[model samples]
Target: MNEEEIPDKNIFMMCEALNCDALTELPASYSIRSCRPDELGIWKMMPFDDADSAKEYEGFMSNYFTTTYSGKEELFFAKTLFVCDRQNKPIATCLDWKAYDEFNTIQWFKVLKKYEGQGIGRALLSIIMQRLEMCDYPVYLHTQPSSFRAIKLYSDFGFSLLSGDNFGIRKNDLDECLPILEKFMPKKYFQKLRIINVPKEFEDMVNKYDTNQF
Candidate 1:
């Protein structure tokens, strides 16, 4: 989908009006919407730029197609929105959707660093949540431990940690997997584990960790 194919110009106008110096510099009111084919170029500006990243993106789309097209689900919502320049060139994005399951999880939310701190991420999240509520399902999402902003946004919207082993970690050794698990697991879950018989060695591993490395 090209810029010409975007049925609504309001998205473009609203983003442009912010006059953001960089994609990450966008204001709070700026929100995300569905992406058009032509807007894919802008969507590509998201942080990941490697083959592994590309493959994961393709996998998400494939899952959407199979589940929605196969009639296993009723609604399949994904996003491909552009953070536009004054001239409507996309500068940032957040794109993903929910499957119509009782456990609806929001996946693949991202934005360019240049557009951070502006309300763009929040806006996109709100749009997706509204859509999810309309479908009558509760929402959930997973984010890297380093994605402090994303976690805060989800929390602000009333999403809390689901109980009992949300981390999906099975390995007993902390050095082998705890760091990665920490990055993605909810904070409340992490706190709960701390009260148990956590080994001093494991606590040390977690204490010195930095989520951005992942």
Candidate 2:
């Protein structure tokens, strides 16, 4: 039967199976309490040694920061957690704490697509907030103005927009116009400020384009 015709029980089983398959693909040592290996083929389908080393390194560093720090950093790390299906595959993801002290920013948020909305996003957000409450840090995040659904979710969870800033250009503002033009313009007319480390042919094409006037 087609997806819409499938019974809720079957649909849930399918979703559970998909999640379990995903978990098996997770990196070694990652933990999940809800999903177990024997309940599905999760362990057999796991990535083995084929997983990307870079991804493993990133995970290691994140775990290290959480373990090494005791104060804010530790709290931030605790806030950042990942949950996957039985296969250890990530269906939804979020960062619990991201802080740039110089910029006075602390962002705790999740980004999930429509198809992955099986209440996973809400559950992940709730976990972050629970950890944050213990740490006593105010939680905040940034999103596009177009994200009405996300805005509503945040509002329902007691977040409010403090201010808004316009990003694009406006014609009437001459002061803004000058800066915009200057920002986009080349310095010394033909001088290249950055270079792409590509093949010789690509570099030659870029140089040729740089010399040609519009």
Q: Which model scores highest in lDDT?
A: 1
Residues 1-214, model 1: lDDT tens digits: 3322322110000000111221233454443345564544334435465557766676555554454335522222234455565555555554434333223456657766676776777666555555444344334344433554555555555554332221222213323223443555577644433212333433343235332111
C-alpha TM-score for every candidate: 0.48, 0.38
Angstrom error of the Cα, residue 128, model 2: value is 0.4
Model 2 CA lDDT for position 125: 51
lDDT at position 145, candidate 2:
29
In angstroms, the error of model 2 at 80 is 2.8
- lDDT computed for candidate 2: 0.34
How well does candidate 1 match the true structure in TM-score terms?
Answer: 0.48
> What are the per-residue Cα lDDT tens digits for candidate 2 across 1-214?
3322322110000000111111213233333233232322222222122346435555544453444333564344344455565665644444544333211112323343432446565555554444444234334344432333444444444454432122111112222222332343344321321212223332233233311110
> Model 1 segments beyond 4 Å from truth?
1-33, 38-79, 100-103, 166-214
Q: Could you tell me which 10 consecutive residues in candidate 2 have the lowest summed lDDT?
A: 9-18
